[model samples]
Target: MRDSKLIYYRSGCHSANFTTWLIMDVIVQDVNPAISDLPCYWNRETSKSVGLQSTRKLSCLWNGVDVYLPFNFIKNYFEIFGAFSLNHGVKEFDVSHSNSRVLTPSSRYNPREEFMHFASFDVEGRSRVLCVSAGEGVPLSTQWNPQGYFYPTQIAQFALAHYSVHSQAQHRENIKRYTIQLEQEDTAARVRDEDTNSLVIQFKNTLEFALSSPHLVLSLDLKINSDIKTWFKVQLLAEEEGELFTLLYTQSGIYIQSDGSEFQFGFGNKASGRWLRLTRDLFTDLKKGLTHSNDKKKAKKLKRTKLKVISLKFYGSGNVANISLSDGEDLRMFLDGANWFLENQDENGGWPSNVIFNQGQKKYPKAAEIQPGWYGAMCQGQAISVLSRAYHVTRDQKYLTAAEAALGPFQKPVAEGGVKTVFLDRYDWYEEYPTNPSTFILNGFMYSLIGLYDLQNISPDNVIVQLLFKRGMRSLLALLPFYDAGSATFYDLRHFTMQTAPKIARWDYHTTHINQLLLLATIQNSTVLSETAERWRGYMVGKRAPHN
Candidate 1:
């Protein structure tokens, strides 16, 4: 194991075992499960309870190096980890500013809302690559931001409950960061020699993704299966009065395995160590899932399904031509889930609390609200964001109308200045606690609007759409204390470019889409918006995307 270049991490332990998924571990210390004589997790100091804590520190030695981890992490570490961190993350790029780095094999980034960036990329060619990281939140997200009063100290990745990474994770813009070396590779190099040379790149977990696109038809995902065919693509259209999501497939084979396999995926923030365990578990089990199914026909069927699952395309990276995978069936499910979400949507034109089914009926949970000040409105705005995406993806006018209806009820000024947000109660559910709302719900509300606007190209007449496109400019002009040009990067900057100061925090992977929207919106009307359009067009025309 000492000389082994391939390293695997599960629950933070370097495991040579291929069976483990590279998912984050969950730790719990018991306050004592009095009823079952089980351990209890409590802080003991504040009379507060904590999860399980094991003293066992495990490690998988590699290349004379030891990667260690603590035990009792299944529940204490992995299970309770947050989906992603809310910070810009720790990535070190060369001084050039154009070159970006990846944190782990399974990681993506969220610089601001509206744009999607990679913590790092595992490239197979100049273009063929994969990013196993997530950005902090949707576009215009400032909830977890430090300067934002509501979640001021909540920037770390580990602090948030159920957040896979640590809370309070932030980027020190003043300092140049560097990615740690454990299992690292230059994706661009892979992209450079994709056809002549083949590589099997491994991420933090068992997840294995191979990208080889010589031409479209001959592309390879995991490994080059000399004997198989796989391709699934999509075409969106607006029918009679609704939108449709069309799934097309070119080739496939189905398969089933003997042993049960693990599967999971996540996106949000880059610094989040989420990819480690999940990828580990997924790739290992993926191969295992094929054990019993060597049945060529079965393999073909599964392959087809996998292709279709990956076909839903979005403008990935910084350009429109660089199409990348959207969140597959889950992305669609987000829409389907809205059907159930609609009933629970607040009477206002927005969503209610995010529902978790229990007795079969959809629920609007008032308990999760941190403060009584924001509740109904919080749920409502969230619903519109989802509904809008559903409509955009499916081209469903019905869904768009549903989204409009949901947001209609709660549209009120966020804090004044004609900057409106859905009103949400900040009161705690049981009345035992009171949490801050003004800043918290406000960010959520704005984020939802920004997210909806990210899909504006799909529906030009969206009421929320125009508001998002034009509001920030007016908001800045109104001069809200929150508009920090020095530290912020909003999507609709083009609309404000001529009015904005020269220095901007270049967050490449941020709400770039909103940037895209502005660039595309103005690119067509370059004549009228010449001064503003020229600067905005950098998103497309300018090759160098300044690093934030």
Candidate 2:
């Protein structure tokens, strides 16, 4: 038999095309025992009018008859009044389409109005139900208006809903499967090494974890043949979209020089054998390198460039082997250094300029020889900050006690080996040393101020600490006139009493000064100071194009 297309017949008119047909098996049942007494039958005349010429044989079910209908003829029986009491209405009906069954008269149906409920099941057992209003205040006896303009709209909505749900489920499943595959591949890659001479370290998981790490510590057991001056050539391969690019890191700095125009910035380096720590600042340098371009607009556009660390290659002169890499979160590698600091702490609750613990002697012999007075104020401030943070993380009273004791030097009068000072013309400042009377360096003072702020987190009620913090901030703010706003430069010196000013300005000093100003403004919540920091930041942006 030739297939027949389901077409709606309105009044006595039938659609001309009958080439493609959709077959459906439907069984109507009434759940209410009271409603089961009502009679229901397929409208033979209506079905024939729509080209459904064959009479479907009915079978007895629990409370209703089972009948097969051409997909087009299902709508004609929607208003079969005798199937159930009109007062109660045919609350719901089930239609078997394809492999699954759909129940209609969903929650969207209203007793006062008419609606079309559509449902379908796929071979995979997935089901979809859609409900649409026929019209507001439509009579139930009028049989859903198949010829109405909204009829096609409702059908399209149901179709779109089914397709969207199915497609979304398929898409989600595909993504989950792909993720699992990648994870397996990553695990395999971690254990497998590429055939190469030099040592190469690559992350198996997504590059995001490695790139976002604040610090990366590379530890290796290196063997060199002769006394050769050698440096490791570090390369980072990143993929953006489908294109691949490389960033190179040398002792000089990190750069990407494709067209011979390389912009490099130096991040501090440590010794070779021991763990080499690359701080968050290195990532900042990478970001700067990626965004560095001749055209400012183009540079800004590349701000969101995401670089995945596909591979890390270290090329060196001698044999580089047994390489391992760790980020900041690797507590196993971090705890060793923290333990050393705790063990070597001075009896006065302070650390010296330098402490060396000889492994053979099994004692920190250099601890006694070193003097805390020789250490710079900036170093002391950094140590205090470190200890305070250590306490914050570990909740150890020893670290807190040590941090508080370190603040004693900054609080003492200049006469006593401390930072307190009342210089010429009341130009007060935090002196680095009491003995060596010299110009106050902004960086050193700012470092101390930042340390105090960190300490303040624990001792919020310490009045003396608060006073010193405010004083340091105000003193720094007072020297703002020494800066050249036009050039975004800071003069190296601003002596007490405003005696002699140097014409020389350092670009690096200006950067540090601006950073300090911004930090102070943020912590203090001073609008004037904030505005000053903003002005300097804007000026610096135009002058040097530093990374945000």
lDDT of 1 by residue, 438-524 (tens): 222223333343434443544666666556535432332232222233223342222232243323324442233223323333323
lDDT of 2 by residue, 1-548 (tens): 21222222212113653222223323333234422222223445557778876544332112233223333344444321112123356443333211211122223321111112211311111111111111110001101222121121122223222322333344335321101112233322332223444332333222221232212333343322233333442233333444333444334422122222233322213223323333121232343344444333433443223433344443443333344433321222222223334554555444443222122322222212223234345545655555564565468787677767776667666556555665444655665433333446666667677767767766788776688777777776676665544645544344432244443334455555665665565557667656665665555433333455
Best by TM-score: 2
**After superposing candidate 1, which stretches have Cα over 4 Å from the reference?**
1-93, 96-334, 337-340, 353-369, 372-386, 392-398, 413-473, 476-548
TM-score of 1: 0.29
Shift of residue 233 alpha carbon in model 2, Å: 22
Worst 10-residue lDDT window for candidate 1 reads 152-161
TM-score, per-candidate, Cα-based: 0.29, 0.36
Candidate 2, superposed: residue stretches over 4 Å from native? 1-350, 354-373, 425-428, 433-435, 483-486, 491-505, 541-548
